[model samples]
Target: MKTRMLKIEGPRKLVLVEKELVLEDDEVLVRTLQSSICGTDKMYYRGEMPPNEKYPLFIGHEGGGVVEAVGSKVDEYQAGDLVMSFSRSCTFADYFKTKPINLQPVPEGLDMRIAALGEPLACAMHSVLESGVQLGDTVAVMGMGFAGQIMLQGARKKGATKIIAIDVLEDKLKLAKKMGADVTINPAKENLYQTIMGLTNGQGVDVVFEAAGNQDSLNACSAILKHNGHLVLYSWLTQPVTLNMHRWHQNSFKIITTTLVHHTKYERIVWSEKAMRPFQQGLIDVEPLISAEYKLADIKEAFEESVNNDEIIKIIIKP
Candidate 1:
């Protein structure tokens, strides 16, 4: 069968091209129901590709859909099973095929829309788990995007008494407050240092999550953490950034890197299921984080809007 897939022909160029798919013996065919753009996708869209990677390639990794078909050797999945994607098989398309290992079964009774965001949601949740947030501890999330929004709620679940969400966009900070943030700081407008110090009573947060993949956000995260506090690094900053490293050693910060899929495939599958349980059971909210939706054919416009709009938390692509 043929699928309308996205191809990054070059920098700032996205075109939907036809791809003929043939299922392998250990593979499963998925009819994509929902998918969304990731921060990493934005990097490739803008041409900040890795040194070894090139353009004119398939470029999407977060989505979920129903199983349309499965290969003869595939026993873990069958036709009509709802599954969330966990690998890059050009999910920005009508349909795609992958090994069963890359497809995760949707939890019972969870919204398919949330399930469609399997990869990112799972990653954020895992990061929160790795985040050493004790009961009554003060925590801050550096960005209010999709992952950061979810992390804010997850931090609360993990027993962060004061959840401070920082962002430049008012809408995201507003949504962050509505979700679970006790305090929202727009560093663009207000004095972040003074306000954060006042709120923390001059001590600073016990943990800070660097959700925004930029130099400024990283700097701000470092500036606000208490001595020996956990600095949960979540962003995949594609570009090199210069940071003031004096505080890192002087303050004795414990840097934590939480990349969920870096685990073995079996570990990833097991951990992904564990990470999604809270979302499935309504402990965390994802429905509101999805700010917009666009059809597959209108991806160019979608990418354009996503790039230009700072308030859009997450944009779903419907195929």
Candidate 2:
């Protein structure tokens, strides 16, 4: 069958191209349902990523679809199964071929639109788990994007008594409050260090999550981390940023880098399954995070919105 897929020809340029599907023995063909734009996708769209030029590069990974066809050797999934995929199969398309192992069945009754966020949700959950948040611990999430929102909720679920959300955008700060952040901080207007110190009684928080992926946020995180505090790094920074290493060295901080996607396939499989339980139980709220949706044909406009709009937490593409 022929599929129409989005291809990136240059920075901020996208074209819909047709291609015939070729199924491998261990692969399955998925008819796309929902695909979402990620922060990395924005970087690629802006020509910030230095990985490869190779114009017409395939760009989406967070998506869900129904299996339309299965290879002869694919026994675990069939033609009608609803599945979430985490691979570079260029999911911004009507149909794509993927290995069965890269697909996870959406839980019964779960909305496929929300389930398409499995990849990012799992990564956020993994970071929360690795942070080792203890009961009644004071926690702070720096940045109120999708991952930050999810991380704060996960911290709350893990027994954080006082969860602080920090961001410059008032819209994100408001959403953070709605998502159960005990306190919200706007660093642009208030002194972030003084605010966090006052909130924590001058001791700082037990765990500080740096999700903003910038030098300013990193410095702010360092300023408010208590002695021996755990600093959880959750963002993917494409460029290098200056760090306050003196503070880290003096306070003996424990830095935990929780980039779950970098884990081995077997490890990710185990962790992703465990990470999804909270979502399955309805504890992790993702519905409010989906800020916008666009049809596949309007992908160019969708990319423009994602790049220019600061309030958009997530954008879903439906084909």
Candidate 3:
């Protein structure tokens, strides 16, 4: 069948192009409903991600849709089931094929639009767990983008006290506050180290999350971590960045790197179901963070707007 798909035909250029999809024997063809933009998508759009994705590659990984057709081997879902999927579903298209292992049936009464965001929330959940945040622990999260904001929420749910949110954008800081961040900081306008020290009684935070994906943010993550504290690196820095290992070594800091793609499909699904349950129940609301939505054909414009507008957080593309 013919469908519209986002094609990365060249560096920094994404265009909606018609494509034909053929389902293999083990795959299920899904009619794309809603696909969300991620921070990694932004980095790929700007040609920063390494290993150089081949030209004309489809560009979406997080989304939900209906089962259009099931392969002969697929028995878990019928043709009309509603499902959410992650990691290489290529959901930019109106209809795409994925393995049954990748698609999870959305629980009853859950909004597919928000459920499309399960992947990011799950990754944030993993990072938060890896950070080893304890109740009453002081935690500082750098960056308030989609993933970072969710990470802050995860920290709050982990019983973190004195949760510090840092970003250069004032609007994001406001969103961070809405997401239950105890304190927000704009490093451009304030000193992150001083504010974090002051908030934690000069010992720095018990844990720090580096979600901003930059050298400066990594440095701040190291500086803000207390002795024997945990530093969770959740960002994917596309370029090679330097770090001062002396501080980490001397302070006995523990650095942890976690990625959603590295996780097994079963692991991802279990954690996603648990982490996204709060959002599904309206307890953890991310409505304030979804700044824009666009149809599949207008995704290029959506990406451009997201890059140009500092106030924009998460942008969703509906097919």
Candidate 4:
């Protein structure tokens, strides 16, 4: 079958091309219901990705869809089954072919829009779980993007008494407050270190999550973490940054990297299923984070808006 796919040809260039899809026996074909642009996708669109991961890349991995066809060996999925796919199989297309291992069956009662965000939500859940946030512990999430916003709710669920959401954008901080942050800090105007120290009585937070993927955010996260505190690294930093090892060594900080996508196939299946429970039970609210939606034909404009607009949290592509 022929499919319309979006390919990132170069910086600020998105080309929609038609191609024939040949599904192998181990693969399944999906008709995309909704696909959302991720932070990594924006990096690729802006040509800021690493040298090895260059464009003309097939961007986008966060998507949920109905199975349109299944291969002979794919017994678990059939046509019309709702599935959330976690792969770079070019989800910004009318249809995509992927193996069953990269797909998860959407649980009953979960909205498809939220289901499309399974990849990121799962990553946030993994980060929160691995951070080992204790009851009544003070937690701060640096960066109020989709991941940080989701992690704020996760920290709240894990029994954080004081959940501080930090970001440069007031809109994101406002949404974070609405989503259940105990305090919101805009570092652009306010001093992050003073505000956090004051809130914690100069003891600093017990756990700090760095999801902003910037050098300054990382440095700030390290600065405010308490002695022997857990510094959860959730962002995918495409570039290298110098760190202040003096503070980290003096405080004896424990760093935890939660890259969920690197988990084994079986492990990922189990983790994704377990991680999605909070969303099903209303513990995490992703609806407010979806800031905009655009047609697949307007992908160029969508990419530009996603990069230029600070108020935009998450953008969905309806093919």
Candidate 5:
């Protein structure tokens, strides 16, 4: 069968074209309902991604859909089952196939639209879980983008008493406040180091998440981390960026790199469900992050608008 999918022809150029869909013995075919534009997708679109791909590569990695067909080798899901898939490839299409291990069954009452976000949410949950964020800790998220916002929410759920959200945009800062950030700072307007120090009584935050993929954030991450604090680098820096190791060495901070793709297949399946449970209960809402939506045919326009609009948190495409 033929499926319509989004392809990245080159930097800043996206095309929606029909492609052949081949079924694999161990794969289950999914009719994509909703797929959202992720930070990695934006990086690949703008030529900022370090990991290169062949031309016309399938672009999306976050989405949820219904099972259209079940392979003979698959038994975890059947046709017509509502499901979400992550850390897999070729998600931006009317139909895509995945191994049973990568698919997570969506709870009966969950919203499928937000279930599409399971990948990003799972990454945030992993970071929070690994960071060892505990009750009464002071946490600071260095960005207000999708993953950063979700991590801030996760930090709150982990029992943080003081949560500081940092971003360059005023609108995102407003959204951070709504998402339970006790403090929000625009690095452009206020000194990020000063704000973190002030919020933590000059001791710095117990946990600092570096979501901005730049050297400035890298340097500031160490500065804001308290002695023996945990620092999670959540953003993928495609380019070579310098880091100040002096503070890291002096403070003995535990710096860990967080990535959803690096998790084992079994770990992803476990966390994907744990991550989506709150959203399933309507406790952690994702409605504020969805800034725009488009049909598969208009994905090029959607990508262009999302790039120009820095205020956009997430954009979903319907197939």
Candidate 6:
């Protein structure tokens, strides 16, 4: 069957192209239900990270769909199964086919809208689950974007006594307050280090999630980390940021990196279910995270909005 798929000819150039898809014996065909834009997608789209032959060449992954058809060898999933792409397969299209191992069934109670953000949500939640955020521990999330917002909520649910949300954007900081952050810090306005130090009584926070992914946020995280703290790297450094190694060595910080999509398919499936459980149970709501929705045909406009609007959290495209 032929379907409309997004193809990035080069940086800042996205065009819908017709592609023929054939199901292999071990693969499943999925009818796209919801697709969203990702930071990596914006990077590729803006020419920050040029698409190479090996990775993110076509810039489409954040999405979930229902199983339209399953191949002969696939028995674990059948037609009409609610699934999300686990492994990389260009997903910004009406339909696409991939290996059964690459498809993960949405959690039992999670809404399709939340589960549709499969990879990103799983990644952020996984970071929180493994972040060593214990009861009464003071935590700081260094970004209020999509993943940061979710991480803030997860940290709060994990019993963090004082949750600090950090971002330059006031709009995100405002949302952070509604999302359960006890304190919101806009580094652009206040001195991040001094403010966090005051909040923690000069001891620093127990864990700091580096969700902003930049040199400044990284530096700020290092400065306010406790003597022995957890630095969960949720991935991203926008444009190849430099790391200040002084505090990193003296503070003896525990650097943790969590990106669920980078692991084995089985791990992605298992971790995703666990990571998304909170959302399924309504302990966390992703409705606010979805800032806007656009039709698949208005694909370029969606990408353009990502560039023009920093307040836009997650943009979903329905085909």
Model 6 earns a TM-score of: 0.95
Q: CA lDDT, every prediction? A: 0.91, 0.89, 0.83, 0.90, 0.83, 0.86
Q: Write down the TM-score of every candidate.
A: 0.96, 0.95, 0.94, 0.97, 0.95, 0.95
Instruction: Kindly give the stretch of ten consecutive residues in candidate 3 with the minimal lDDT sum.
Output: 48-57
Model 4 lDDT at residue 241: 92
Compose the digit string of candidate 3's lDDT tens values, residues 1-319.
7888888866678888887888888999999888888888887787775676656567888888999998898898889998887777888889888898887788678887777776776677678766788999898888989878877887888889788899999988988888888888999999888988888878988888888989999998898889999988888877898887777899998878878656787787677677666777776667777888998878889989978899998898897
- Give the poorly placed runs of model 3, Cα more than 4 Å off: none
lDDT of model 3 at residue 145? 90
Candidate 2: residue pairs that collide: none
Which of the two, 1 or 3, has more lDDT?
1
> lDDT by residue for model 5 over 1-319, one digit each (tens)?
6898878888987877888888788988999998888887888888875755556567788889999998788888899998887755578888888788777888768778778877777777677777789999999899888888888988888899999999888988999999899989988998888877877788999998888778998888888899999989888888897888897888798888777557788876776676667777776667888889988888888888878888899899898
How do the candidates rank by lDDT, highest first?
1, 4, 2, 6, 5, 3
lDDT of 6 by residue, 1-319 (tens): 7899998877778889888999889989999999899887887787776333433256678789999998899998999899977666788899988887777888887788888898888889999999999999999999899999999989988999999999998888888999889999888888988998898889999999989877888888888999999988886654666778787788888988888877777777788889878878888878988999999899999999988887898999999
lDDT of 1 by residue, 1-319 (tens): 8999999988888889998999988999999999999988988988888677887889889999999999999999989999999988789999999999988999999989889998999999999998988999999999899889989999998889999999999988889989989999999999998899999889889999999989999999889999898999999877788998788899999999987877788999989989999988889878888889999999999998888887788899998
In candidate 4 the C-alpha lDDT for residue 24 amounts to 95
Q: Write the per-residue lDDT of candidate 2 for residues 32-144, one digit (tens) a residue.
A: 99999988888889887654445669888889999999999999899999998776678999998898778788877777777888888888989999998999999999999
Of the pair 4 and 6, which is ahead by TM-score? Answer: 4
Error of 4 at 90 (Å): 0.7
Which pairs in model 3 have colliding backbones? none
List the candidate 2 regions with Cα displacement exceeding 4 Å.
51-54
Instruction: Kindly report which residue stretches of model 5 are placed more than 4 angstroms away from their true locations once superposed.
Output: 52-54
Compared with the true structure, the alpha-carbon lDDT of candidate 3 equals: 0.83
